[model samples]
Target: MSSQPYRLYYDRMTSAFVPHVMLEEMGVDYELVHIDTGVDAHETEEFRAINPNMLIPTLGLPDGRTFGENGAQLVMLGDLHPESGMVPRIGDEDRPAFLQWLFAIATTGHTTIRRYSYPEEYSTRYDAQDSVSEAAYRQLTRFYSVLDGVISGEPWFLPRGFGPLDIYTILILIPFEGDALADILDTRPSLARLHAATHARPTVERLWNFYFGADA
Candidate 1:
């Protein structure tokens, strides 16, 4: 129950999914403001004033403060609502490893997904876009493999149970699934199971429907 009014600026079907789900799970009062990336809404001065980087998932607080970057935002939310147990307490056994994977998925998987999705943004050479995308997909698969290896099949990333880190894993994995990448996910049993479990969560399903229509 934060006294500050919160707003999430996001694009449809984007990386903002994670924080959206997190906010729903936390049951906080907030507003969802959609921006059309295709129309360069992110690059506009008004939006840039909220987030200099013009990134989706820029969180606005009542005090006129804004926060961006998915990793920092997730950690902040978890810290703010310790009763939710989305993050471990300082002396908890899983705290160290939880933090490690949180950053791992954020830095490695998130970055690779961005490259795979928009190679043209990362590469100036039009001819190299295909090669860059291919390499990024390969790297993304490898990052998934790393995650698969770590799962002990307990339905959550950490031994303690569900946490914010699991949400991070789901966000990073969502873009790479349900098409040609299905085979890649099928090969990793643990990760696949983890994905299934994460997606089945009530909060995720509710938010998915909200953000992408009921048909989604």
Candidate 2:
């Protein structure tokens, strides 16, 4: 057993759900430190100790090293425990494709969701004469269409089989689901298939129910 028992500092519910599900899937003994994110508890000193950027999902290892950011953390977990089989390390051949879609989801997909979901931030930006909500919807729809065209019934983001990429992609959508999710999925059947597969998995369902039963 590894001495690096994982510790998660995250919101009660958020994209942290992704790695939370991944750890459960890995069946690793871990500890969680719930900070009730967005209450600005995440902005405090104690929380900042783990992640200077004040990000959630920071994992502290037994070696005294800590990590933050969902993408980097999952990739590191995959590296530390090969049995987890979630991602490639510095030298692994799977790195390229895994990293590619990782960036795609985080940047092209996740950011757009957040940008639109919070119209207050973009409402005054000069980028649009249209309503901030409309621009956000348009950006989200474009990405959803792209996702629909790409993913198939395959379990993974790439053809490499289910791993961190798929986990993160599905988890990124947690903040923006419900009727909007259905609408987005309607535009892209592929994403709906991918979402269904991820949510249907027993491990994912367990975490989803626990994290998002009422909130999501």
Best by TM-score: 1
Q: How far out, in Å, is residue 69 in model 2?
A: 1.2
Q: Estimate each model's TM-score.
A: 0.89, 0.84
Per-residue lDDT of model 2, residues 1-216, tens digit only = 457677877676667887787788888878888877667888889877878988777887757677787777777777777877667666777677677777788877777767766766666766563577677677767776776676643644666567776777676566566896787777776677778887789988887777778754
Judged by whole-model lDDT over C-alpha atoms, candidate 2 comes out at 0.73
Residue 39 of model 2, lDDT score: 75
User: Least accurate stretch of 10 residues (summed lDDT) in model 1?
Assistant: 207-216
Give lDDT: candidate 1, residue 61. 66
Candidate 1 lDDT by residue in tens digits, 118-159: 899999999999999899988988888999999763788877
lDDT agreement with native, every candidate:
0.81, 0.73
